[model samples]
Target: MKKKVLAAILAAAMAMACLAGCSSSSEEASSDAAETEEAAETEEAAEDAEAAGEETAETAPAADGELIRVGIINNDPNESGYRTANDADMKAMFTEENGYDASFAYSLKNDEQITAAQKFIQDEVDFLLLSAADTSGWDSVLQDAQNAGIGVILFDRTIDASEDLYLASIVSDMEQEGQTAVDWLESQGLEEYNIIHIQGVMGSAAQQGRTGALDAKVAESDNWNLVTQQTAEWNSEKAQQIVQSVIDAGTEFNVIYAENDDMAKGAVAALDKANISHGVGKDVIIMGFDCNKWALQELLDQNWNYDGQCNPFQASYIDEVIKKVVNGEEITEKTIILEEKGFDATTITAEDVEKYGI
Candidate 1:
């Protein structure tokens, strides 16, 4: 009986040890499986993160180093020949090859331009280059740019903002351009000036500056008569309509003072259709701004009386200013006015057209 009990106890002990060994093996297997799953999950997360980093690198404007990001806000390239040349000049200068990562925004309206400026500021561009459509409504946006630590450069046109708002202004002296044209008109010494003043986009810097001198002159001079004053908005067709309406009304006008070459061309088209002789010593004198090659050619051929030079090639000056700012150099000249002149039909030479034409 004692042998029987001892054997039974040994058998039970063996069974218990086997059960404990089985449990230990099962726990080890579970741990190994869990470790493998965790490692796979970690690897997948790393791969996803790496892919995201690559995408960001691809989409970013600047490279690893030395790329100057610029945001150019300008008028529509198709707004006029002058604008087209201006846009082309900016594009040519601010290129990847030229060490700039430039982005462009265009609008003829002031509100739209301000919106673009806000976007560029939000984008954190290194610089903001502007050719404002209108002179007003810029103080707030420019101040915002200043607050954001972005450099502001004015080109082609001026704004009503304070000088402190912009780092540099490389622009045309528009009022001077108007004064030059008016001075030339005064030099003509017409006995009785009956003028059809065809203007550009209303409230624009160009329109205001160009018109201000003429308006003052007309207001002061007793002999000067404004047959009609109208805005063409820089559209040739609108200018034609304005002239045609005057013609139909039989308004006696001896001068067509168009604010731009395209508008002047339109005015001349009306004169041609009416068989009204124009050009040197003709029935009317044609005056225009923006020395487009064709417009200057018109002056050279004695078809247009005068063409004012607006100097659309401001890229070199702007590039230099940008370089100075980047290098932490002081900008001595706050406002750099481009040198410009007016060409008379009687004196404009082919060489002059070749040299000064846009």
Candidate 2:
């Protein structure tokens, strides 16, 4: 009886061990299958992510295989007709169709322009094109751009920053423009010159250059007198008010030197309203800068005595510079000066108005 019980217990123990082994094997197989499936899903996800990245890169803007990225900073487009034309020219040149991924920022304030530059730097732009509203306070931001391997080109106006900070400067000679206008005025040989000087935004290169020549001339000469000098901020209405105030005060002035055509138009409007004669060989000698078409027409008709030419179409020059930069070629000129001239009512022809007018 003892042998029988021992044999039964041994059989039952072996059977239980075999059952446990089978269950362990089944669990191991299930775990292995699950791990393989997880690995496959992870690899598919990685591949999809890589493909998306490539697609994004392919769709991005480039000049040829890769688009050159440019950030342009300019003044308010509506500030004046010249500015409008300038902005339009910039827009036309810096386009994706022309092989550039371009971004633009516009402001009349210096601080705001600096902020925009910082943003463009953070975005890692390849180049920065600037037409600064103010000449001062650009050093630090331009230095930051230089540190980041970004090239800078100055257009329209120059900042007070170091030349090393920029690759090239394509600008009008503002001081020369002013001097030319003043020279023309001097040639008029007015016996007693009393002037109403209307300036653009204060501290701007245009204003400083234009105002400096006239101011110096007036200070040196006994005949040339500034009846009133004020900033019209490139606004016609403000210019009109400035002139109206001078007229209301019975301040006798023979010359109106407006910094821009819009302001000149405003000053003329005030003169017209006051029943004052102006223009060629009139009571007041009207002088203005930035030869807008209408203003040049005014000159051609002898309705304005003088208009100074400030060339606004500088995009082509800028584009060529950028191409040379991209190709790692030497820029022969550090400062590219645009050729400009002034027009007189007496000599300005219809062709001059059509060809030179902005």
Candidate 3:
């Protein structure tokens, strides 16, 4: 009986140990399942965060194909070769095909130009392009633009503003252009001759440049006298009238310093009507600025003594600057000074005409 009781107690202890072992195994299995589920949840959360980050990045600020509002203030649409070409280039680049919104204004006076600039600023244009008719009277307008966060780009002509006022300039050096034509005239070996200076609008940059060299020459020399100096205001009829007046005044001038091709052409018309001998190989030597096709043809035909090249195609460069600024790219130079040369009437060929003629 006692042996039977001992075996029964041992069996009971074995049963309890088996129950404890099963409970511990079940708890371990539950703990392992919980750990796996927690790991999966952690991985899913990480993936969700990564996907959200990608979405934010995709929606972040980008410059690709962005709309840029550009404002252009230039001379009259019917101004001249340089301005005409510039207008065509802008039209080509800023149309629906090129994907830009552009507005343009034309003026021949500083106050009018400033008013146009003010309008652009009021409209909150992204950029402002200027071809100033006069150098002065732009400080206030430009300052207002800066205050409005508009970037200014000078083209064709420059202003007398501080360097920080404008972002860049794409222009021909007017002084250099004048000096080039005058220097070429000097090389023609003409010593003693009266000259008629048919000038542009007074105080304009072109007038300042084209008039400077001849004025200095007059101030220094006694042999070459300026028979008449008058402002044609870049008008052909006015130029003709000025030349006719000089002719009627009985002045014996053998050289004509017309500030532009149109004026020079007008002067030639006057000379022709009056039966005055003129041209490169004639009694009177003629010099003109702006290598327009017609004017350069005149040079090539030896009808003009010299033609100075003043490039007016500013759209390509202005486009480049706008793209760079939009893309956060660095510009190597803020103020780009385009180099130019004079085309001698005697040496210009057809190839020169094709390449350099406007």
Which candidate comes out best when scored by lDDT?
A: 2
Which consecutive 10 residues in model 1 have the weakest lDDT in total? 54-63
User: What TM-score goes with each of the models?
Assistant: 0.74, 0.74, 0.73
| Residue-pair clash count for candidate 3 | 0
Where model 3 places Cα greater than 4 Å from the true spot, the runs are: 1-63, 109-124, 133-137
Q: Is candidate 1 or candidate 2 better by lDDT?
A: 2
User: Which lDDT value does model 1 have at 4?
Assistant: 59
The digit string of per-residue lDDT tens for model 2 on 203-237 reads 87889999999999999999999999999999999
What range of 10 consecutive residues in model 3 has the weakest lDDT sum? 54-63
Candidate 1 lDDT by residue in tens digits, 1-358? 7975676566556545554654565455556657887754554454443344323323222333357889999999987788888998899878775668899999999999999999999999999999998888999899999999999999988788899999999988889999999999999999999999999989877899999999999999999999999999988899999999999999899999999999999999999999999999899999999999999999988888999989998887787788678769999998999878899999888888887787
Worst-scoring 10-residue span by lDDT in model 2: 54-63
Count the clashes in each prediction.
0, 3, 0
